[model samples]
Structure formats: C-alpha cells, structure tokens
Target: MFRRICLQLHWLIGISAGLVLAIMGLSGGMYSFSSELIQLIDPQITRVSPSNAAALSPAILLEKISQHSPYVSSLSLSDDPEQAARVGFMTPQADSGAKKFEQQYLNPYTAELLGKPASEDFFRVVLNLHRKLALDQGGKALTGAATLALLLLIISGMYLRWPTTKSLNWRSWLYLDWRLSGRDFLSRLHVVLATIAMLAYLVFALTSLSWSYEWYRKGLNALLGNDSATISKTANASRAASNQSPSKALDLAAVWTSFRTEVPHYQKLILLLPSGSASTVQILYLDKQAAHPYANNRMVFDAASGVLQTHERYADKSPSAKLMASLYALHSGSFFGSAGMLIMMLVALLMPVLAVTGWTMYLSRRR
Candidate 1:
C-alpha cells in the first residue's frame, strides 16, 4: 500500500512539476558553455595581442574609460598578456524595459575601448529564465516550489524502482529490454535512463535549491556554518560609512599598487568599485594555480586612502566556507573539470526527454 502511494505521488509530481524542471534544465544546459560560446561569437573583444610593455595602471584605464562612461562599477584585469580587461558600468536606463548594467572591454596596455560583447543580452535573458522564469518574485516562488517537488519526485521514483531480492540483476537494473512492447518498453527505457542519470540529477536538485528558496538558502548556510548575519552587518557598515563620508572618489592607482605589492601573482584580478555612496572597494582574484574557477581570494580596501582593511585567502577559509564558495563550481560540474562540465550539460539537455516520456506514459494510463 505504501509503495502504491509512493508511485501515485511520483507520477502526480512528475506530471505537474516536471515541465518547470525541464525548462530549468534546458536553460542551464545552454548556459553551461556561455564563456566558450561568447568567445566563439566574437573573440577579438576578450582576447588581445600580447604586448611587451606592461599593462596600464587601473587609474589610467579608468581615465580612458571615462571618455565613454564617467563611472565604472568594476574592473577585471587578466595576467595573461593576450586577454583584455573588462570594465562594468551602471548606465542610466531610458525606460522600464531597458537594461541598466553594462560592460565593455579595454586594451589594458593601450587603454583602447573594445566595444561591448556580442550575444550578452541573449544570454542574460537565458540566465533570467533559469533563475526566475523571467517573472521576478512570483517566478522565483514557483520555481522554488517546483525544485522542491523535483527533489521529492526523485526520492519517490527511486523508491518505486528499488528491486526485490528475486529480480536483483545487472540486466534488469541497468539494461533496457527493447523486446518488450507498449507500456512495458516505456517503463524499462524510462527507469534505465533515469538510473544512469540519477546521480547527476540528485546533485542538480540539491545544489540548485540554494538559489531558489530563501529558507533553503538559510538552512544550507546554517548547515555549512556560514555567518550570514556577520556578512550582512559588514556590508551594512560599509554602506553606512559611505553615506557618512562626503567624497565618493576611489584612489584606484594606490589600491592597485598596494594589491600588486601584497599579492604579486594572479591569473586574473577583478576590482569591484563602490556604487552609489559605498566607500569600500572589494577586489577578488584567482591564483595562477587556482583549485577551481570559483576559488577567489578577496581583499577590501578603503576607497579614498586605499588602505587595506581586510583580506581573505581562499585557502584559509573554513571547510564550510570553502564548500559554500564552491557551490556554483559543483552545480555546473566545473569543479571536476571540462569533462564533468560537458557531462552535466548533456544530462541537463536530456531532462526534456524524461519529462516527455513520463507525460506520454501518464496520459496513456489515463486513457
């Protein structure tokens, strides 16, 4: 009776939440290779000719960018001599539908403006769909519910497919019986493919919920011993300090010099400038031999004096902190490497297959 109830719940959730899961999965799969895809579209903007001369200082690059946009929210510099620096800006929007954030590349050595990237807007839409179904708060809630339902579905489906002692065999569990017809074949194919992809789906459902629901995020944070309140307080303090101060200008040259002197080696360096009235500047960079793409060391500096206030090395972070930091890498499978990323992407793309097959079987049963 319990098994029957579980099977019924599994199909019910599969029919209802499965569509949303498929949408999420397909969007995620497309976005997995976003960087590679963008580079394929236009390589010149991001890539630069290697120059013998040292790259220009952050202040000079900012001065050059001032000709295009007066305010820069952030700057990304690459140690690879052949990569261009990226500058982010908060441009004024003409209307409600217009985009407010913008980014453009610069020749770090010559300070030449490299126009905005291609297909960024399209990718932005895809990202929005994955996160919130492009409907903002309401979509977030719906997606969160669906993600939670997906977790339950995975559990119930696994339970329903558990083999009895007599039927326990590699062929029964792993291989599809193509000889069977109608519903029997469908059942065999569905269970077999699902079993193959079960681990990947489990990872997706578990890691993705961290973004979809606030309660889930907080719970994960607590579980990982991340001090959310402390982080919030520090951010609030920075904003309050900015409001109390009269000047908003940052000494980019001094901060860059200080950073270079302290940590001279890095593959890529990103300086996050203060927006609005914020008085602190946060800089993040990856080591020459970073553990993963997301393993970034962080530093906070006073915008005016360029005085180093705080620094956090990725290596020095607590286990929980490191795990929390690595959530994105784990979710996208980049933590493992290029092969893992491709595998995860393929698995994501196959989500629609599962949904369609499940729906077909459900409808046929109903008839």
Candidate 2:
C-alpha cells in the first residue's frame, strides 16, 4: 500500500511539474555555455585584440572613459592581451526597474570604447524565462514549486522503479531493452534516462533553492558559517568605522601591482570603484589556471586606502560554502569539469524528450 501510494504521488507530482521542468531544462542547456556562446556569436561585445604596449593605468583609463562617455560605474581588467576590459555606466535614478547599469566593452590598452555589450540583454531574458517565465515574483514562486515537485518526482520514481529480482536485475535496471518499441521503448527510455540524470537534477534543485527562497538562502549561509549579515558587520568594522570621511582618490597602478602580487595570472579581474564613503573597492577575478568557473573569487579593498580589506578565496571555503558555490557549476555540468558540462548539456536537452515521452505514455495508459 505504501509503495503504491509513493508511485501515485510520484506520477501526480511529475504530471504537475513536467512542463515547467522541460522548459527549465531547455533554457538551462542554452544558458550553460552563455558566456562562451555570447562571445562566439558576437566577439566585439566581449573580446579585444591585444596591443604591444601595456594597458593604460586604471585611473587613466577611467578618466579617458569618463571623457568619452557619461557612465563610470565599474570596469573589468583581463590578463589576456587579446581581451578588452569591460566598463559599466551607472543608470540615472530615473531609468528604473531591474537595472542600474549598462555595460560597454573597452580596449584597456588605448582606453577606447569598443561598443555597448548586447548579449547581456539576451541573458537577462533567458534568466527571466528560466526563473519564472518572466513573471517576476509570481514566476519565481511557480518555478520554486516546480523545483520541489521535480525533486519529489525523482524520489518517488526511484522508489517505484527499484529492482526486485536477483541482484535487483542490474541489466534491466541500468539499460533499456532495445527490443521494445513504441510506448514500451519510450517508457524505458524515460525511466533509464531519468535515473541517469537524477544526480544532475538534484544538484539543479539544491542550487536553485538560493535563487527562489530568501529564507533558504539565509539558512544555508548560516548553516555553512557564512552568515551574510555577520559578514557585513565584519566588513563594516574592517572599513575603519572611526574614520567616516572618504579616503583620497586611489592610484590604480599601486593597486594593480598589489593585486598582481596576489593573483599573478588571473583571466580577468573586475575592479569596481567605490560607490560611497563606507564602501569597499571590490575585485572579482578568475584565475586563468582554474579548472572551472567557480574559481572566480571576490576580494574587497579599503575604499580610501586601496589596501586589501577581505578576500573570499574559493579554495578556503567551508564544505557548505563550497557546495553553495559549486551549485552554478553543477547546474551547468561544469562541476565534473569540461566533460561533466557536456553531460550536463545532454541531460538538459533530454529533459523535454523525457517530458514528452512520459506524458505520451501517460495518455496512452489512460486510453
């Protein structure tokens, strides 16, 4: 009776979330290589041809950029001589809703504006579609529910599909019988593929929790000893609370040298100018040698003094923090390295196939 109940519940949940999961999977597969794809589709918005001379001093580049355009929100630096740095302009307070900045690619060597990046808008749309069908909060809620449902579906399906014969019929459980056709073939494919894809689905669900639930995110950080509020407090204290006045304008040359001494071979380093007296000048860098994207790490520097304030090294993170950070990579299948990403992409592409086949089998049964 209990097994029967689980089987029904699994079917019920799968029916409810199947379409949503399918959409998520399709969109996710597309976005898994978003950074690379965007660049490939349009290199002007992302890459830069390297120059013989060293790139301009950070401060000089900012001054030149400001002269060329009104915005000066933040900028990125790359070690690759061929890649241009990126700069963003702060949106006027009046230009409201879901954005406060627009990005422009810049040639760091000459401080010349390349062009306004367009791929950002495309990804934003994909994000909306993936997160909530572009419905904002309502969409987020729906997707959150779908994520939970999919998780339950996985659990129930596994229970119902558990092997019972000698050695649990390893061959039957692991591989589809090629001899079957039509609904039998589709059903076997759905079951076997879903089983194979369960780990990726679980990773997607757990990682997605942070995007959908504030409480879950806070709880996760706290559990992982990375309470954001506590970190903020520590950051404030480190900002030198006694000195309320803003520090002098930073010399980027000195800062760059300092940063290089720390991370000598970063792929790209994003340096955000301080926004307020209490703010830290932020640095986000991905080491060129890192095996995956999760190695992109963050550092905070004293706004006035340009001294290293705090560093969040990927290697030093706690297990939970490490897990949380790995969520993005896991979702894209980069967690297992390049080969894993390929597997991840395949799973995403197969989601819609599974959904369609499963639903077809369901309808056939009802008939």
Candidate 3:
C-alpha cells in the first residue's frame, strides 16, 4: 500500500511539473556557462584591461557620466574585477511620461567612457527566461507550483530508488547487467541518478519557494530569529539619512579599504556605487575560508559620509537567513566554485533523462 501510494504521487507530480522542470534544467545548464557565453557573444563588454595606474575616483566617474546624462538613476561597479565600471541613468522620451533607464561603461583608470554594454546577450536572456519561467506575471505562481511539485517529486523519488531486499547485492547497487536488457538498464540508471540528484533538487526547490512566497520568507526568518522590526528600522533610517544629507561626498576607496580590512579573507569583492538620490553604497563579497557556504557578506555604507551602516557577516545572519542563503549557494554550486558548478549543470541536464525513464517504467508496468 505504501509503495503504491509513493508511485502515484511520484508520477502525478512528475507529469505536472516535468515540462517546467525540464525548461528550468535546460536553461540552468545553459546558464551554468553564462560567464563564458557572455564573453563569446560580446567580447567588448566582457574584456577590459585594468588600469596600469590607480583608477579615477568614483566622484570623477560620476561627474563625467552626469555631464552626458544628468538624470542618471544609479551607478554600480562590476563585481568582476576584469570588467569596467558601469554608470546607469534615465533618459526621457517625448512619447513616455517616465524616463527609460540604461547603463554605460567607463574605464575605471582613465575615466574615459566606453560604449554602452549590450544587455541582450544570449546567455543573459536565457537566464532571465529560466528564472521568471517566461510567464512574467504568471511566472511567479508557476515557479512556486513547480517548486512545491519538485519537493514532492524528490521525496517520492527517494522511495523509488531505495534498495529492495532483492537488490541489496553489489551488482544492483553499482551496475546494470547487459543480459538484463533495455528496460532493466533504464530503470537502474533512472533510480541511481535520481538518488544522487535528490538532495540538490530539494535545495533548489526550497530556496525558490523562499523567493516566491512572502510568508515562507517571513516565517522562516522568524523561526531563525531575524528581527523584522530591526531590519525595517535600519532600512528606514538609512533612507532618511541619505535624503537629508544628499550632497555629502563618499570616499569609495576608503570604503573598500575598510571592508577589506574588516573581512580580510574574502577573495572576491563587489562594490555598487550609489547614484542620484540614494545615499547607500552596497558591497558584496565572498569569504573563501568561511566554514559555511553562504559566507558571502554584504555591507551597506552611507554614501554621503562613508559611514558603515550595516555589516552582515554570513556567520552573523539569523539562522533562517543563513539556511536560505546557504541553500542558494548549494543549489547554484557557487559555494564549491567551477568544478561544483559543472557537476550541478550536468545533474540538471540529466534530470530529463531521469524523469522520462520513471514515466517509462510506470507505463511498462501499466501495460
């Protein structure tokens, strides 16, 4: 009875979410190599030689950019050290009441403006489609449903893959006999791979749900002891202060120096400069030596005064936030670097095979 129930739920969820899962898997596979793909599609945007000397100040870069487009929204520096700095601004069109925002690049060292980087790269588009499920407004619901389905699928799949009394032998665990024929071979492969990928799938599904549902995020945060009120107050205070002292200039270099000094082990650092009316500069970086995968730290600074407003270490995050963040890192394989990412990409590509084989096994039994 238990076995039968498991099989029914497995197929039900698989049939419903299979196509969506396949779409996500395929797109994820493509996105796994996104960095490389972006470079190949548009060499200019991806390639930039660092300045032989120290780059121009953020103030100078902002001044030059504002001269060309005064209504700029925000400017952000590339997290990738090789990439040039980017300045974004809004331009008003006669037909539209609101201005359209765009991004431009500049040589950090020379402060010379580079041509606008193309946003329509192939991999980027694929990533966007995958993340949003290609449905815009409906995408959120679809993605949420798919995530829930995946959770069910993972649980059911584990049961199907569990070693039966007859299959406890070494041959059943590792290899499929050629003499056993096609059906047996496929069933074995399906079960084995599904077993291996189950943990990763669970991580992906749960983290995705955290993004789609506010209740899920808030509930989880509450469980982890993240103070909602404190976070809100901090955000509000940051905004008010920025508005009051909008003219005060920030020292980007000093901010970066302070961040590095504070988090000396972080190997990769990304600084996002505030533009227009915003007073906070955000920095995100990964601590290579951290014990946990979600050890990517985020710090927000007062753009006007360069005062450190919020410094959130991975270890210091609320338990819920840490879990959520770690799940993302694990799912994306960002925690493990290139080799782990490749493994995840391969697992994503193999998911369709597992899904199809499971269906085939059921159909064979039904007939």
Question: What residue runs in model 3 are displaced by over 4 Å at the alpha carbon?
Answer: 71-81, 90-104, 115-120, 166-174, 228-280, 285-296, 315-320, 362-367
Candidate 1 residue lDDT tens string, 1-367: 9998998999999999989888988998999999778867877887888788888898888777877776566788887788788887765567774435567888999989888776766888888888888999998888888888878987998888888667678886788766899987887778887888888988888888888766777788788788977755754654443223123577888888888888889988777777556777778899999988989888998888889989989999899888877889989999998998999999888788889889989998999
lDDT ranking of the models: 1, 2, 3
**Highest lDDT scorer:** 1
Between candidates 2 and 3, the TM-score winner:
2
- Residue 323 of model 3: what lDDT? 67
lDDT of 2: 0.75
Compare the candidates by TM-score and give the number of the best one. Answer: 1
lDDT of 3 by residue, 1-367 (tens): 9998998888878877887887788888778867566566666764578756666656666667666655544445544457676665556678876556556666776666777546445665677667778778698688778888888888887777667786477555556555665678777787677766777777777777777787886776687787766755654653443223223366766666666567656555545555546667776666766644447677888766567878888778766666656766677776687788888888888767876886787778778
C-alpha lDDT of candidate 1 relative to the true structure:
0.81
For model 3, how many clashes?
1
In model 1, the worst 10-residue window by lDDT is: 238-247
Candidate 2 backbone clash number: 1
Note the clash tally of each candidate.
0, 1, 1
Stretches off by above 4 angstroms in model 2 are: 95-99, 117-120, 222-228, 231-250
- Model 2, residue 110: distance off in Å is 1.8
lDDT of 2 at 43: 87
